[model samples]
Target chain A: MENQAQRSPKRRISKDHWTAIAFLIPSFILILVFVYGFIGWTGYVSLSNYNSLVPDFSFAGLKNYIYLFNDFRFQADLRNTVFFTILFIGLVIVLGMGLAILIDQKLKGESIFRNILLFPMALSFIVTGVVWQWLLNPSTGFNQFLSVFGIQPKWYTDTTILAGFEWGSIEFGLPVAIIAVVIAAVWQMTGFSLAMYLAGLRGIPEELREAARMDGASEFQVYLKVVLPMLMPITMSVVIIMAHISLKIFDLIYAMTGSGANFVTDVPGVYMFETTFRGNYYANGAAIAIIMLLLVAIFIVPYLWSSRKGDK
Target chain B: MAAFPIGKLIKYIILIFFAIIFIMPIYVILVTSLKPLDEVSLATMWTLPSAIDFSSYVEAFSKLAPNFMNSIYLVVPATLLSALLGAMNGYVLSKWKFKGANTIFTIILFGMFIPYQSILIPLIQFLRTIDLYNTIPGLVLVHVVYGLPITTLMFRNFYASIPDSMIESAKIDGASFLGIFRHIIIPLSITGFVVVAIWQFTNIWNEFLFAVTITTSDQQPVMVALQNLSGSQIVQWNVQMAGALLAALPTLLVYIFAGKYFVRGLLAGSVKG
Candidate 1:
């Protein structure tokens, strides 16, 4: 009887553990089918000759990828994505870290300034796109203000490449029109980095800074040397987060400026959407998506792996 | 030396300058939306409206109301289901601590960073096969499934702060799995629920790529409809501005009210899980 009593509790505990795992099973299966399984399916579609209205699962090898590389629009997309990612990530970090440090100074009306900067994060990228489209309209909006200083730049409508050089079917230098889209994107996303850096800043101990000050470090040096290094992890998180968003950016560019005149603002997201849905070039679209996924995975895989390892 | 803090003055000046530039869009949106269409030309872009008008808002609201309702229907259910599932998964992952839990979690977290375009082709095929394409429920399922990673990440981190000893004591008291979850985890993680819900609500509400591709007219969400507002041949800048505000209103309101929770969600979603 006593033996039965002890084993009963153990059996019951095991039963409860089974239930715990059972609850997780449904989500696990859904993610497998939806996330992982669908990715495999996409890979298959990318490899097939599925380029028409009807499904064509016949093998085409790397023809779609080769076509994209040689194509003018897709080449432009690759260039635009590279420049946009670099400029957007760079500006967001500088601007975000700057605002974070300024706010950490604990000035009067700190919350108000923080709220104003962060409110844009709440608004949709579509709204940001639409509103900025007007605000930066070549002939109107900010141009009206800037005209007082005798300058009016055609923002998104400008088709000029800033430092032009031919590398492939298109210019491989910065596209001036992309700057307009970048401005709106930076405005919307800087708040995320700011919040992250601010959180990181707050988590840091005051004693560390006090110790630096006692050692005769200037405020700027203290932040540059002591604080900035400490915020490196947060910076990594921000870069990865922003890099992924920048890589797949569509709505903002779509609504703000559709592929510019020379496909200057086009990225893979826009290309994939247009070619697949509008043009019905399914295989090509799948290829673009796979490329985008690969680009994002380059940053994400390492980050996720390291973080997971760190957790253990 | 200057008696005044010149450093403080420079700081305020710099902050205010950026603040003005940052809020310029809002100012333009407000000013333009209140003006008559004739008064909304490029020449008068920076000027405040000669008179406040609600006509654009009336037009925008009429066009957007149905779609706004679609967003609400999509967001509420998706947020709830995802948050609930996240809480359940989080409970098991954090307190249960079975083998391979971290690996499973890392696999799931990868989903959060993936470009949705990668999965678009097959996802559409699967949805169409199930006859859920072009429906709000389909969008709901998409949001919930995709939302799982972040929501799970958030809830797991939230629950991690909760000590394991509590669960041990409850186990000692002979509470079963469901009983412990029902009586213990739920009540303790109410704030976690709020954070996760707010995050999911904002994301699903503001999401464009899915809303645009998945559903068509009449079933479209407000963001898609607002995007369509500018597609009309004769672009009414006033109406466009008003529609932008209307579409953004729900999330802006959430940020305004529950901003603390919203920021907490932001931190939780991004920082190491």
Candidate 2:
């Protein structure tokens, strides 16, 4: 190949180059149209007055955004999403790391426990939502069973707000109803963070632990000072990934508790879906989507940039 | 490595507790599905059914049967087409390096991160324009298109592990690009195909947003159908649980039999990318 390339570099370059281009062309076109192109179109729709059943592409110019910011449902969505993302990511990290540590103890039936934990990751959020819905039903399901123990709680229907404080056009506090959704989200995603942390735990050399022990560090001290620091990068990845999933969460919330009592579990993704399809508020939905994209971008772009830099 | 007996017991207790927490919902679903409708109350959620009943499965299966078939039709072809496209893209991007190839790869990779909601409005419009709206083929096209980024990333990373000299040698034998991909790349990447296929199959099978939005009732996938089974005013807990299980069975089976590969796919899809 080297000798032939030297003999006729031009012919080889053109033929191979075209072939490479040919192979890439289909994907390129599809991605360009579907991903990039559709995003552009969505951006356009967000700026237009394309509300109602009929398509009206007249210039709206941030009107929809302004309306959504003022709208009560959208405001509640923003608040719910913020609290959900924090609580969901926090719980997933803690539970995931704890489980990783426990499983890393070289216990019996490690694969059984790992597989059981990770199996939830295999099911759709839709299925997870359904099962969780039944389990968390305020009147039936676990409530009935738990009532025997003198414990009765409105699982997802609980709309009590904690740390309640008034903010500009929205209540800035944790909506308690989100806890059920958070539990469901954490259950499904803990496996992902667990897998990551487990791999991170395994990658840390045993010699380091021995070294820590030789320095008179206790087991917990070694974990805190050495192992924890080593797992920082994995934790960052987990946070970003979990944050992204939480920000765009739809299926579980949609299936489990549709908007909850008084929209306590309402999220931007659900609101966007309902507005676009059910209410025929196309432009409003587009605005919600663009906001979601921006939110996801804030988490993802930096990660992608750093990963690209690492690649070089 | 030895701990106090008390500490070891505590560890076992904690592990068992979480294991129960994780498994309880599944257990409830299983037991609930097997109970007769009259006995399917939340109070009996933990009880053994007096008699095993397959009636719920029969009812759920008959209702979900069409949608289940839709998921199969959607998953198989979508997986194959995307994997094929990804292999070709991966081969070229990794082995047949070109000017600005890295830029192109990065651009495509960006597709993986964009929230799908951001594009749905225009995606529906585009589908309607192409006359594939509300059809199985339309959903397939959407899945293939949206699936391209991750699939390409997986295959590219996989093919990168293949030494470039293999391609160079194939070239030396007067093989064209297609010839090399067909013989050298395809044969070498069977495991790659399996990984990508499993990833895509589970994903497409379990995907809800596109399945719900793109196709109406008759064309709906099982995931959407499963959601619908519980949408009525009067809920049948047994049938709903049965439907949920039936819907989840394929992916669950995949995770059970080929869990290692599934985890590999997850790691490859996330950790590397």
Candidate 3:
């Protein structure tokens, strides 16, 4: 009976279907023109090397791709993206779920906790970036404050060798940028994830919790085996959404690092822009855009299908 | 019904810890903004202001010349249009099943994840081609298209949750498409519209990437102007933090009013990613 309730009522499905279709045209046009249309146009442009202002692009036939392989920053961008993805997706989900679980319990000032957690979600990353830059800058930020306590938090420090590898590689390294991006994004989004987990937690029947408590299951045990598994759908949704955001991150990196970022902090979206419009490599930018879009699709469509299938 | 005092204590501790982490940087920014330049030390960026000062807030508003007003101008109209159109689109897509309906919805949902930067160049090019790129009209068009998927999705899901028999009854009474939406559906769904408004308002108000890229002038939006003026002076920390706070205040004020739905709606409706 509960499961039956979530479904759209079957009566007048046909009429509702028609209305849905009618109302859908504008969005359909947006997707058709902007989503696919951009890709199609970009594909055409990539083939012709139109660098700036629609320069007469002669067909280059995969030259851009070949050039990209050799392009140092391109390779660095891909690697940085993967690293950023792994960290952002990982932390946002773990910390998000962690924070979510911690807050799920009915507590005093729970709403206050929720508000503080969610406040960052309402901030523009451009603003957040400025805040973080100030927070991280060695000369002006809390890093400088650390000096008063006899601990220096240097924004740009030389690497120290460790075991077989070098530590704190400043040039061509993104330790500071990575920390800044992850901290800011997680602070902003983990609350979102927490909210999601809370939703799932709310959906868990009181009887279930009662049953677990009745069985002498410890609080941690009940959560580990019961709440955790039950929260899978929420977890999946959180991961997928975080992954999508990680892939498309631009404002924070763009604002913090600016144009002179030691070739570090370049993600696909940034590279895509750098290639597409900034570099005037429209097709390559489009190609980059396509890849980023596909990455997004890979995360979203499957999850949708999986959830839908789960429903069925 | 449960009285686990220890668990309650633990929960409070954890919540307090995260609350501190969440509010710390914002607190630091506030303190920094409120302190005068002379009171600032080379160190102790985390310390409280020596004296309570309001000049930063004043300068941020007055120095920038309607600094706060410009953001409201752009955000209010944009939010209304985006949410309105989004609701309309969601209604059509969810209620009407025609050819390519699912496809259309899916693609539009896909737009949810498209980074504003990936298309920034081409979009700028496209916008410039029409001379609407830098104008508010141009930004409005972009925001509408971008805002559609989420807002529409919200309306769609909410509309879907409503019993279909009620809709059929409205239709059987000779209600037309607009008639049902205006009289029957929209009347029942103020919450969904409010959720969309909150989401849209926050998003557009806090938006930076497109605001930075599309609008070329300091006269555009608070976000653009704030960033443009950030380091214009060697270290105008007071002004910058104040500007940042001013940039944050409107949305924060909005959030304070309806922060509950900010969490709730995010969990229920899909974020565009």
Candidate 4:
């Protein structure tokens, strides 16, 4: 590297380039050391059983992974994570697509709508999780409030007292966590999807809409038949990002339940945190992380690639 | 025209409905925050406060004082310095077109999706080894690494869009790289650069996971502290709500002030590239 720098003396150097390099080097080194270096070290640690409060290391290869496989909590957490991602991705797309369609209507006060829609997104995770947790806490939140209105609805603890759906059981666990977090997330995310979708809507040629109208299509028919298909690219954009978010969802669970080891609601990220930091099993935490990485890759890489191809 | 009016009205209705539902949670939070502590306890949380009270704001400010300052102590300098340096990287890579530039960009893009948790295990140890663990700089470095990719990518896209002829013209006239950048590029790219800066500022300000894990104190970021307050259930709800508001206020203010930058800047990468 030094030799290349020395050899490049005749290459008409500029302070801008030097400054740029200088500015970037710190961040580059930070990422390289903290991210890549740590990942490589995690790979190493996964091979050993590193316990907490002990400045010791051992070399036990693949046994940690094997134990990780046999661990029921790990398996259950895997299922819970998959469940969260599926439900979250599904709802965000449906509701987000709906919001995008509705908001895309060059209506009144669009910016106000946009800002209100986007504002919740600015709340930190602690705020997001705590707010949602308080609302859905059943005894002290929305349900209790509703009870005073002569409508005692049991929303969060299952039994879908929402007047339409009957889930048949009152389970206050992962299902509630998923539903609660998704509502909070959707409250925060629909704006993002709406923004992207509005951009997509704006991108569509006005001629297409007029042409649909000229074809004797009603406005509803035009929106349904002509506009929906055009929104796929933007819809995919929202899905890919939200899918990644849904996968490593730790903050919501941690803020809600404080990482309880007893009940369910435990996603892989939380499990990894507890397994490593709280439980003193660093190797096992690495194993959980490896699994999380694999799961995210399986979901996101394809979406980004296909979208890139979709444009082509 | 008659049929069009009906359809348009329906669209407005649906949009308003969805918007209301979307903002309902935040509205709930606002009302929750304004209620008196006793009123918040005895009364239902969904309704408006019987009377406005400011004591909870005082309590929350005090409870959140340590972490609130901790967040400022970390996010401000971290965002500014990172953006400054990140722009340099973006500018140099875009303008200089040095060797391995493509590889560097590719690596940065790859870094975007790599799960941060995977790096935490070794990071804790590495931080300990280097004595950077549990410190503001360590946490800021973590944020810088995360912040650099998107910000640099943004600045690069924006800088790349600036015509090469202007830069070359400056170069031919004996304008050094810095001179060209200072005179031509930076000024031209200021809007986009500020856009990226705002994005990085909001992001670093809102971050919780890294701050919580990397820094081991109640003096973590505001988000981490808000989360710790989550456990003290007997803790005053008004104060809790107030803390939540205080923690989120700066980012909200930033978003409001930099409205265009946040919207346009957030979408800049996708929009420009």
Q: What digit string (tens of lDDT, one per residue) describes model 4 on residues B1-273?
A: 445587778777877787777677678778878887777763477788889888888888888888888888888888887677667777877777766666666566546667778888877777788898888888887777777777777887788789876776676699876777778877897787688878877878887778877887654878888887767866777677788888889988988887777877667644426
Q: Give the C-alpha interface root-mean-square deviation per candidate.
A: 0.7, 1.3, 3.0, 3.3
- Please report how far candidate 2 places residue B261 from its true position, in Å: 0.6
Which residue pairs collide in model 1, if any? none
Alpha-carbon runs more than 4 Å astray in model 3: A1-23, A144-150, A155-177, A259-261, A274-284, A307-312, B1-8, B63-67, B98-100, B231-235, B271-273
Deviation from native of the Cα of residue B210 in model 4, angstroms: 1.5
* Candidate whose DockQ is highest: 1
**TM-score of model 1 vs. true structure:** 0.97
10 residues in a row with least lDDT, candidate 3 chain A: A158-167
Which 10-residue window of candidate 2 chain A scores lowest in summed lDDT? A3-12
Q: For candidate 4, lDDT tens digit of each residue in A212-293?
A: 9999999789888888888876676677778778787777778765433333466788888888887878888888888777
Q: What is the DockQ of each candidate?
A: 0.85, 0.74, 0.52, 0.53
Runs of candidate 1 with Cα error greater than 4 angstroms are A1-13
In terms of lDDT, the poorest run of 10 residues in model 1 chain B is B229-238
Model 3, span B85-170: residue lDDT tens: 87787667655444556555666766677666545555676888999877777887788878877787787777777777776677
Question: Residue A252 in model 2: shift from native, Å?
Answer: 0.4
Task: Please tell me which model should have the higher lDDT, number 1 or number 2.
Answer: 1
Q: What is the DockQ of candidate 2?
A: 0.74
Return the lDDT, model 4, position A41.
84
**DockQ value for model 4:** 0.53
